[model samples]
Target chain A: MKHFIVGPVETYKEVQNIYKQPYLYFRSNEFGEFVKETLNRLSSLIGNNDKNSLLYLTMSGTGAMEATIENCVTPKDKVLVINGGTFGQRFCELLKFHNIPFDSINLKWNESLTKEHLEYYENKGYTTLFVNLHETSTGQLYDVKLLSEFTKRNNMFFIVDAISTFLADTYDMSKYNIDVTIISSQKGLCLSPGLSFVSLSKRIIDKIYKTTPSSLYFDFKDYLKNIERGQTPYTPAVFIMYELKAILDLIDNSGGLEKWLSNIKEKCQYFREQICKIGLNIPTTYNLSNTMTPVICDTVNANELVKYLRDHYEICVNPCGGNRANYMFRVSHIGNTTKKDIDILIDKIQKTIEVLAKRN
Target chain B: MKHFIVGPVETYKEVQNIYKQPYLYFRSNEFGEFVKETLNRLSSLIGNNDKNSLLYLTMSGTGAMEATIENCVTPKDKVLVINGGTFGQRFCELLKFHNIPFDSINLKWNESLTKEHLEYYENKGYTTLFVNLHETSTGQLYDVKLLSEFTKRNNMFFIVDAISTFLADTYDMSKYNIDVTIISSQKGLCLSPGLSFVSLSKRIIDKIYKTTPSSLYFDFKDYLKNIERGQTPYTPAVFIMYELKAILDLIDNSGGLEKWLSNIKEKCQYFREQICKIGLNIPTTYNLSNTMTPVICDTVNANELVKYLRDHYEICVNPCGGNRANYMFRVSHIGNTTKKDIDILIDKIQKTIEVLAKRN
Candidate 1:
């Protein structure tokens, strides 16, 4: 079956082959070099090219978010989190769980975090600003550049979760002055899920050293020490590392990150146009992420369309859960997806919608 | 190269093939079934047959250890950890980092925990007893039966890190009255690294419900809630989970856990006898684990021997690090290691030792 879920999108053939190789021992020199090179390439891709600045965690995207809160936010630090979707809400939950004092700018799922929204938290003695660059739940890409400027003027550390936005959009950690930038293996990386990465600036590293992390697994300092020798403090997902290296090499070979982002943009544009042509609503309040498009159901049932597309056609699209289950369904444009793949998916979705209309 | 590292061992051919399959979207019903079946099989293998008693963490073995501590141990709980080697030392560090009051029974790398030593902390109001059943650093297998009896009598919670010794040795979590048992995919399961499993007894879950975990990623309560629907709280290592299911099926097909343990025993015994016949020293201060055997370098240079075997013979063995680097090297008997592979490794090691003697 064809998978169009937001993350774990279809991978490149070479990436699949790389993941098939046997697992390497984490302590091996060969594996060390692989880790070192992968981190270096990833740093260059996200514009955080520096020695000993990035760390790989054997966890999911949420784990990386927890790491940032555990390492950067102390009890004394005031924090502001942009809560627009599920992932953004997670940051608020983590900060609360850790007993850190924080305020949240809660936005509806379809709402965007704009420069105007930053006015209340600006210069409020907030030491840190946390946000999901692209909220996966609503397919809304927040204005990270605006947030970056706001944080810079306020002298607050900026932590961005770029899990679904890294390769799909243009993200420069250095330009944004992001203290901690998080990404995962699945999503825009087009690899299997499990591994998450955080690129910590030197300032954030200093903060991490000063505060003791309550959770050992998500501790940034321990991972930093191990990454010095091109290793992780714990056993890593080695096969996924291999896939990561392969994907990085593929990106480098294809004219670097600029061309990669352009390709994803083209795919996203094609999908959005095709879905809109079929008379389905696409939310316009926020800038859309290049990774996936969320179709807003008004007249037709979104869940029924998702089920029909999966059953009648062997195509799988992401069906929303909770309150949005009836109104939204997402189709991914990342990974080895081509315009052709998007065209077929849009055609199948259109047919499913027509079938639903007949049933009504 | 032939790998004899403690983890990332040579996986079975079928398991490797299973890992090569395309990545599955974590939210799909198909993946839900995979998670359900894998957890059921793992619970049965470890003898935790209770409903929703196990949770899978997308991390290494250390992550699961941290999860148990974060979930069960409170600031008021007096903890006693067996500090025998690196893994045991890690638990102490985790407890210390979390500001939990705990004492440790410090044994040398080669030393085993005996009943005489247990008298010191047996009735000392220790609420929890933490141990590494098989210390991976020195291949020293601790006596779980004796520790189980002691914990049961003292009314203390027992937590075991069985990462390196789960299927390689005979382990029955229920029989041992273990509250939390941690295992990883790469060790005795003969799968790749990246996935760690924790089997929490009903007692521990009840305790976990009362305490809020400090870590969001390692939180047991969140995972327990998600596992009811056969999903992890966060995105998991999907490919590694596939390998885990395949390895568990292999164990079931080949006469269950008992037969699997006996097979590993034969392989370990063969390697030990062959090495001893060649005049190499094996530490006898504790019972050796079936997972790996640590060879003591009393006369020969272990580092040089390891390099020679890797370069000239293409056989890779685990070289000790830091203080133990000069004294010990390890050969693994877990995974798909056969008697012939043991013969080859032993032959190469013997040749390398002779070369070292001539150099001296």
Candidate 2:
């Protein structure tokens, strides 16, 4: 089966094989060295400076986002969340759960944030901005350059959830001055789903030390202190950490992040070109992410298309939730997906469209 | 290496082999059924009622403890924590982080909770009580019968962290009137360390639905709804769930928990009797857990004993943290441990004690 459900993406065999070995704990020197090397590799791939502290949490992507809020965001920091989709709204949810005061620039499901939208928050004394760089729920990538410029102009700390966009899109924590960047193992990393990585700048690290977080499990201060010895405050999803190292090595061995990003970009462009030629409508035209394409189905219901693909060809594509469940479905370009695979998917989708026209 | 750390203990070969397969997601009916079956198997193993809700979180044991506090313990409920060791104190820390007021029955490192201790807190208007049934850190298994009687007399909601002693000891949530039971994969389950299980009674589930939780990631409400379809709100550590099913099958095939407990109890008794004959002190002798035995080192330092075993024989044992680091080390009888393995560990410890003189 071709798994393209946006996460728990296809992984390399070597990474999975690492799990065959019995559990490795910090007591073993080999596990300790593996953790330190993986931390270094992941930090390098994200282009973060040495001054920053990077932690791989043992939970999902949402856990990392909440950890960022617990450690970095305080009541004193008035936050502005760019609410575009599910992932964007998650930041607001986390902040609300922690009882932190914040306002959201709520946008329509397919709407992208523009300079005009950010201008309204400027000079409003907001000390922080939260965003999901690639809103995976809708496959819309916001302009980091615009967000960075606005944040720099206002001297606001910027936090980005790059869970789906870290390797699929170009991301440099140093370049964007991103105070905190959150990522997970299942999407671009193409590993298991439990491990989530949080990269914190020196500024964020300082703020973490100065305050008590709302959570004991998701505290970054404890994680940061433990990472010095190449361990987490609690036991982590260690196999995913090994898989993360394997994937990082794969990227580093095949040139670097530059080459990896370009390979994904080429496949993404090829997929988009073939889908358009076959007459499929991608809903959001502006600021599309290379991670996935959100296709709008008019005559053919998106729900049926997804079910048809799964039932007949043993293929899985991500379907939208809520009101757009039957209207839009997503085809991923991340993970170990290839041009040939994308071509086959497009052909299958075309065949699916013809067979399901009368049913829709 | 002969793995013997309290957490991430030695697992069966079949369970480890499950990890070799590629990742499984809820999209597959096989995985969905597997999770549903595992949830049922685990709930049954804990002897939870049919109306109780079970959630397997993709996190460590501490995460589940915090989730119990977040969902079940509201500010309206006055709480009491039985502080015995590191794990018991952890419950206190989690409650404090949420700003919920709770007093603790503080005991010495190896002190056991007794009936006289409970008399002081009796009728104090405490609505809930939290306890680590087996304090894995100090190898003291509290008498749950005594705790249950107290909580019942006081009409308090009883929450227990049965992480290290779930299968090793006799536990019936219904029999004890336990409102919540917390367990993790790495301890008695003998699986990987990422997944944590929380079993909530119908009453606790009703309490969870009444108020907003302090955490979004650890919210029981989202998890409870997703569990209806055999899923988590976020993606979980899938392979562990699969391994959990494999373990449950193994336990059922081997004549259920009663037989499993006898096997562990046999090995635990054999180990203690041998250590006593060999002139070693098994500390906290009054109420020790079948899961592990904490040894008190008088002549030979506990730190030296642990290091010598690891360096000389490639054997790992659970060492105490904080002030007891040099005075005590633990030998575990849980997680695929055999009587022969126990014999080997004891022999190694005896040899290490002879080899390292004046180390203390």
Candidate 3:
């Protein structure tokens, strides 16, 4: 009943406070101004060096990804997808659904993309490079700057799925040369899920014009047209937009993006130290995500451990899925989560594991 | 500065009360149960006889329409679109964007699709009939029962864009053999515009599996796959969903669907009578939509009248768009609209027209 699942995580009280105001339907000018302010705040957060970068807010992170592909890829256009975890695999699936031609470079679950991988794809003449900055499935963070540079050298469009990274990670669009960076409200923004945002550079916008026309609801061009008036082509989630505005204000007041990212890193480090003391191995040797920690157990059943903690200690954690289910479990330190929350989770997991190990 | 635009007219204080509840994310079982109960109540209101007529909600009415098309129409299949107003034109545009082969019968703004028009499309061998029950732009309501019969007789599918007509208008899916119906939370449902609902019969579900996989975000299969567990495929707008539950409960407590429809009809009659006294002409002789009345002014500028009323009387009404903008304006009686609201609008419009006539 209690959600420990990775996002739509707990929303901040300030985000909750905005929803209390009277609802303005999406068509209202009040909603329009809210959207405009949210975009302006996002641009500021991302450091608005690229005046040409347009932000399109959508229903979810997946909606943003769908918009990116639907707008950027035409039929038969060859795109290179870098797959390491579930989110990366989703990009390939999206490509397949659109019937766009794609070649994927599959990496191990916790592996980061090396420059060699990008160069190989570039040499193969892939027009776009699709990579996840932080793969939620494996708690791996790739160096997007390195990958962006490699793609730039080949004149390829660098599409980064930064859904799990974004505000919590230091990403300079100007430095990375990211053509399209996708993010969502739930992950690093400390808001509830339901909104997704994509910052598109001019180069990417030009490519979208040449791409095959997509469905009306997901049409990036249609969204862009409405963006001028601070409106979406359809009715957007107005309450979520309000929440986004409040969260953006909070971030601005909290020393902006740098302070937010440092706070996440600090919490992640604290959780990692606790995990080490508890004798649990981290699933990934590569860079871990600031949002969550995936730990591997030597002899404990990860699913059982998750359930025992939740049932007995009233603490929640996510049991790993797919091939990682038996040996791995994940604890999210994202959104409004704090050290106290992490301590409660770790303490519960430690006690639960000890009791379960003795019974076994 | 004030929103006098049609439905989403103004969210009720009761609806705002629901939204103000501390923001619980949708992943919680409490929120999930609320959504499930909301759907159940809506099903009863709209006369969904089949237990299998699944109700799936989306971010907006346009999102629901996009999902319907993505699920029902394959690229290889030909669809028949009935374009009578702005929403109908939108459906045609969606078909174009999706690259689905569609033949459209464009009717005049106030004209309703007759049996002859249906036979013409049927003879042309189209497999689907798309109708907008209440054309929001022109204020005309189609007899969906007749159109559904035509589709059934021709062995084709019937999909209705009932966005503005669902609860306010009478519709019996079983009697009419309607395959799919789409409606939104705003318009006739008297809720905010953030949510859109679609009810599908078994026949449409069968066809969706055969359709080429189009979009990931609005995919029906993904929704269906998750709805059994009372979950959406993505993170939904939790606060809005809570509002929907409150709205549906109010609908049930207010004597259910029959009483709701009668109330709409009575409101329309009163509005029409008042408009006639003000010397305005009801342009559409066909059954006027229960939700709104479109009035034509031979001498007064519709836009000017809208501005005068809003600026002077603090009253809001919709100025007709497209070809009708100069000659006509609309007043909606949909969603949480009371007789007092109608009286206020009518009084303001009469006074505004009198002042404008002197200036002319």
Candidate 4:
């Protein structure tokens, strides 16, 4: 089967190749160098300053986001979260769970973050801003520069969940002045889905060490302290770390990050064009992430379309959950997906849509 | 490299074979059935009643312990934790982190939990007891029957972190009336290290639903709601779940759970016998879990011996941490370890000690 799903993304052959070998003991100096090297490569890829420290957490993207919040934000800080999709809402939910007071910019599912959304929060004593660079739920790519400029002006510590957008889009944490950036393994990294990580600036690192974490496992201090010897406080997803290094090696060897992002953008554009030729269209009302296109399945039931592709052609795409299940599904271009794979999926989707439309 | 580490153990060729394939997406109906079947197999293996519900978490074992506490225990309960080793101390640490007031039965580094230890808390109205079936750090296995009887008479909820001992030891959760059993993937399951699971009783499930979790990612309510259809609330370690089923299949096909446990026992006995021939002995003052044996290395520095074995022999074992680093190490028989593998490790370790002793 072909993977077009947003994540647990289609892992490349070379990336998953790391798992066929023996599991590395994390405390070994050999494994320590491997872990440190991977973190260094990730740091270089993100183009962050020396002050930015990397933490590899064995959790989902949501867990990493919670860790980011627990480490960086407290009740003393008034936080502003942009809620345009499920993930953004997750930040708000976590904030509420932590009993931290926060305001949110709630947007429609199809809406994008704009300069106007940040206007009201300016000079309102908001100390932090939380956003998802690409809201995968609704396929909206928030303008990073717009939000960065706003956070810079308002003196808000910017936090971005770059789960779906890291390598698939142009993101320079240094350029954006982001204090914290969260990422997962399966999305842009094209690894398995268990590992997630966050990069924190020196300013937040000091703040994090001062604060006692609500959860012991989510504590950044332990992870940061252990990284000095290239270890985690607990047993990590050691096999997944192998996958991370392998993927980083592949990216470094194959024309680096720029070519990787461009390839995803090109495939995304190509998939959109092919789907459009067969009367399918993207209905989201905003600029999109290169990772996935939110396709409108109005001619055929979206769930039916997803099943048809999955069952008949062995292609899988995002079956939009909740209300959107009837009309919207996502076609992802990230994670080992190529133009050929996209062409096959689009060709199959084109025929499957016709069959389902006629049945309806 | 051969693995004898307490965890990230030597994964057999068969278990590692699962990683050669693609990563599965957790949202599929097929994945749901696969996950449900794995949980069912685990439940049967644990011999728990239908009142038990299983949760698969993409986290380290410590994360599972934290999740168990968040769901099953609250601040109102007067808790008693057994602190015999590092893993036991973790439970105390988590309880302290959650602001749950608890008393601990602090044992010496090599001490075991005995009837005398439980005698003090007998009539104190303690509502719960936390334990690690096998304290991995010191290779001390607590007597489940003794603890079970004490908790049964006192009417306390019993939570066991059976991360290292599950498949290696003959444990019957139902027979012991265990309220919750927390396990990790890399240990007795013999899979990758990223996934952890907890089996909670019906009583605790209802209690979990009523209480608000301290962290959003750890909210058992959301995990429980999603598991209705064999899904986690967030993206799980999809590939690891596949590995879970693969290993479960291997166990089922090859002599079932009983045989698997027996084999581990045989291997542990063989390793201990072989090590005794080399003048090394089990040092801990307790019954041992078939999982691993804490070895006293008084003739050679523990860390130095560990490095020598790893660098020259390619055999990995637990290099005892903290103060025990000079004289203690542990050799595990969990995961993909076998009798033949143990013999090889013993032979190499014996010869390596002579070389190290001469150099010293």
Candidate 5:
């Protein structure tokens, strides 16, 4: 309750202003137009080559992930999953739920994913490759472009869970030939957690037509059918949709895509520098996420450190969940987070660590 | 742009206040507890009877309807559906999608459904009966109690799409032996439109377990499995959950269930009386919904009158969509609507109708 837990990041005043009004119902044409405009802006931001690229909104980034698995794979379809952290394991869970056959290339939580893992799966004749562009659980960003090229060369569908990295990273869906890119409103979009979006390439859309429909609510075909009318198959999270529109306007007004990406880069660099100065090491050797940094502290208890920062300093950071909690804690730099906010977080964390050391 | 229309009645100020915050991420335990508490409050409001009754949430009222059908009936399964209004037509659509065999007892758009229909269907060996508590499109509220008794005597599963009725009507799920009851957040709950809920009796749960999985996302079993742990199978509408909690709190704080139902009844009476006083004939004799009034005005173009009211008087009223536009227009009395709001709406309608008569 004292604030620090990564995600659902403390929203800025401007972002909160949009959420204050009752969401105009989605059945109304006004909300429908807002969705259309938001999709156009996102398409422009991503530089999608296919004008027919479809954006389908879901409840969360996880929902989008489930949608990808449900929409892309049929029973007994072989899927190649790159597992580096909790999120990677999630793909395995989805595969299990659908009873689809999947082989996972397991990477250590502290390691970055390389192209070799994908190449291994390609040789094994896997028809679909699933990767997390930004593995939030481990704070590692994958070489998505390289993986996308490998999947394309192998004639396999490429799916990227870009939930935490989409806006922060240079994600050009056109250049990467990414078949499906998933994102959420809460992380990089800086809106809220209720909405997830999946942008579909024509290749994957075609594949979906052949796959068996497992879930009615997250059926990609259902989404595709209704999307033409600027409507979702089900009632969308209207307030989140409104917040997404507002956030898009803010992003567009803030010198557009390139500037926004640069801002994230700068923030990530600042965070990495601060972590290095504090003698903390980033867990993953691969490229770090622009959105968050998973740091390993030799002397600090990650969970206690998180609580100390929240209770004593009013700064919220996420303590890694499950097995990762022992050695790592994450600080997110996504959404409308600024250098000033990060600086405050750093100041609190430094003080907390010193007090924690004294107590030990 | 204008607000009125039957559904998505103006959200309460308190409900809007909760939506103003960034939706807390689903992984947060706080969010999970909030949803659990909301469900608990709903259970209390409905009055606890059977421990086997379960509340499940979906994206919209229609989504809940789809879930009810998809969960209970497999492909080629026999279903009895009452065809009366847009909502009932949606049940037909669900039946068509699942390729289920359905015998529909079609009632005229503005007609009431009686127990005789159920008796007729029961004799035909239909195991499942689908009915609407309030047919929102035609402003029809059926006698659910009579249908429930008939279904019980026949040992049939009774499903009710109570989207616009729920708290507005004096009915109990246990009393009617209604196996499945679906309602939306915005209509009777005074919340926004992002969430739909279904209350299932023990008999329906057993039927769902025996049925083959139809949809992954809309699977009632998955929802029921996770609901006990205060979790949803996917990311839920977090902010709406918060708003629902707030609305429930407000409802409870304001003298609980009895008071809320009484307020709705009072608003319905006031609106119906005002419409009659303004020389508009009620469209249906026996099936008037407490949540809204469908008025027949043959002298003026209903669409033009609705537009004039919105543009000139700054009053939002929905012009009926499609074929229904020529014969009737509806004004809703759901959520936090009061006599004052109804009076303003009636006044605007009177002026608009007078101006339309002059123009014609």
Candidate 6:
């Protein structure tokens, strides 16, 4: 089946083969070298100087986000969360769970953050600003440049959950002044779901050392000690590490992040253009991410459209839950998606619309 | 290379094949059914009642242990940890980190937990008892029957880390009256090292609901809510779950846990007998686990012996760290280990001893 759902997206052949190899011993020097090399590659991809520390967590993207919150956010300092979509709401949920004092700038599903919204939090004394750079729910890409400048001017640490944006967009930790950037394997990495990566600048590391977290699994101090020797404190997803290396190598071999990001941009642009031609509404007029396109339906049910595509064409598209379940469906352009695949999907969706009208 | 090191252990062909399949979308009904089925299979294997809830954590054994501690033990509760080896000490570390008031029964590495030791903690107002059923570091298997009766009489909750011994031994959660049983995939299940599982009784679940844990990744309440619908709060190690189902099916096909346990017992017994014949000392003469055997070296350095085997025969053995670095080496009998493999390992060890003696 052709998979267009957001993540646990289509995987590369070599990466899947790497995952198929028997599990490597986590304590072996060979695995240590692999860990070191992967960290170096990640550092280069994110444009990190040697002053930062990157950690590989054996969990989902949400797990990595929770880890960052637990390690960085304390009740003593105030935080401001940008709530635009499901992933952004997750950061709010995490903050609430930890009882961290925080407020949110809730953007409507199809809306983007503007300078007017930034002005409200300028002198309000939020020590940290948390956001989902590409909110997966609405396909709205939050302006990292504006947020970075605002946070830097106010001397607030910035944390970005780039789970769905890393490889699909040109992201640089140094350029954006992102203190912590969290990503996962299943998104733009095009690997399986399991491992989560967090890259932290020295500033965030210093604050993390000073603060005490409520978690043992995501304790930064323990990770810092183990990562110095190219290991985690506990056993990680061994095969996923190998797959990550394979994907990283693929990106590097194909002219690195610049080429990879442009490829995704082209795919997303082509998909959006076709959807517009098919008379569907794009959910957002703002800068959209090159990850997924959330299309709004007026006459037909989104669930029905997703079902029609899956049953007839053997293709899977994203089905929204909660309030938008019957209104919007998403199509991901990340992973190993191609222009030909998008064209086929558009044709199928066109047929689906006609069938829905007849049913009506 | 032949893997005799504790874990990540060797994998079976069918299990590897299952894991090789491309990633599955987590939000799909297909995955939800898989999750439900895997949990049911795990519950049946451990003899858990319908009232029990089993959670699959995307972490190592230690992470699961911390989850149990965080959700159950609070500052108001007094706890008793049974410290025998590395894993046992880990419980104390977690308890300390949480600031949960606790005392411990520090047993010698090879010593058994007898009735006399239990008498001290009995009726002492301890709310919970934490122990590692099999201490992986020392190859010592603690008696479950004795601890069960003591905890029951004392009206204390019992939490056991059965990581290295779960599939190798006969463990009945209902029979043992264990409130929580922790296990990892890399041990006797012999899959890969990515997922950890915890089985909890209804009583502990009630307490977990009332307590606010210091962690979000290890949050039991969030996990419980999502798991009721056959899901986790975050994306998990997708392929590892497939391998788990494959191994669980293999166990069920091979006459269930009873036969599987006996096979491991036979392998462990055969290995110990061969090493005894070779004039090597068994570190623990007490009740030993079928998972691994710790061989005590009096003449040559254990590290040197491990290195020699790896370099000459391409066999990897577990070398001790800290004080035991020069004294002992471990050989695992779990996974798909065979009698022929054991014979080959013994022959290589004999040659290693001879070579070390020549150097001396």
Tens digits of per-residue lDDT for model 4 on A1-360? 788888878877787667676555678888888788779889888877562289899999888988888888888889999898788888888998887889999999877677877888889888889998888889898998898898899888999999998888888998989988899999989888899988988777878989876788999999999887778998899888888888988987889888888888889888888888888788656989888989987878999988888878888888887899999999889877778887788789888988997897
Kindly list the per-residue Cα lDDT of model 3 for residues B1-360, writing each as its tens digit: 233355665655677675335444354465567666667667666667555356556467888887888888877778988888788998998888777899888888877668777666656677888888888888888877778777877788888888887776787766787788888766776565566778888888777766655677877877876666668876665556777777666766779767868987898889899889878899756777677888898778888887787668766678887767778988877655677877788888888888998999
Clashing pairs in 3: B190-B335
Model 4 Cα lDDT, one tens digit per residue, B256-343:
9888888888888888888998899787468888898889989988889888888898888888879898998888888776678888
Q: Estimate each model's TM-score.
A: 0.96, 0.94, 0.89, 0.97, 0.90, 0.96
The Cα error of candidate 2 at residue B29, in Å, is 7.5
DockQ of each: 0.64, 0.55, 0.41, 0.73, 0.37, 0.59
Superposed on the true chain A, the predicted chain A of model 6 yields a TM-score of 0.97
lDDT of 2 by residue, A1-360 (tens): 787777888777767676665445565566777788778878987878673278889998888888789888888889999988898788887888787899999888867678988878889999999999998888889999999999999999999999989888889998999989899888898887788889988887888899777668877878888787787778777667777878887888889889998998998888888988998888755689888888888778888898889889878888888879788899888877778888789889999999999655
Query: Per-residue lDDT of A157-223 in model 5, one digit per residue for the tens?
Result: 8888887788877788878888888887767777656677788888788888887565466667877
CA shift at A345, candidate 1, in angstroms?
1.3
**What does the lDDT come to for candidate 5?**
0.74
What does candidate 2 score on TM?
0.94
Classify candidate 5 by CAPRI docking class.
Answer: acceptable
Who is ahead in lDDT, 3 or 5?
Answer: 3
* 3 against 4, candidate with superior lDDT: 4
Per-residue alpha-carbon lDDT of model 2 for B211-312, expressed as tens digits?
676668888889888887787777787767878888888888889889999998998899889988778888754588888888888777888788788878
The whole-model C-alpha lDDT of candidate 4 against the native structure comes to 0.85
Q: Candidates' lDDT values, in order?
A: 0.85, 0.84, 0.75, 0.85, 0.74, 0.86
Model 1, which residues run further than 4 Å from truth? A19-24, B19-24
Q: Higher-lDDT candidate among 1 and 6?
A: 6
Docking class of 4: medium
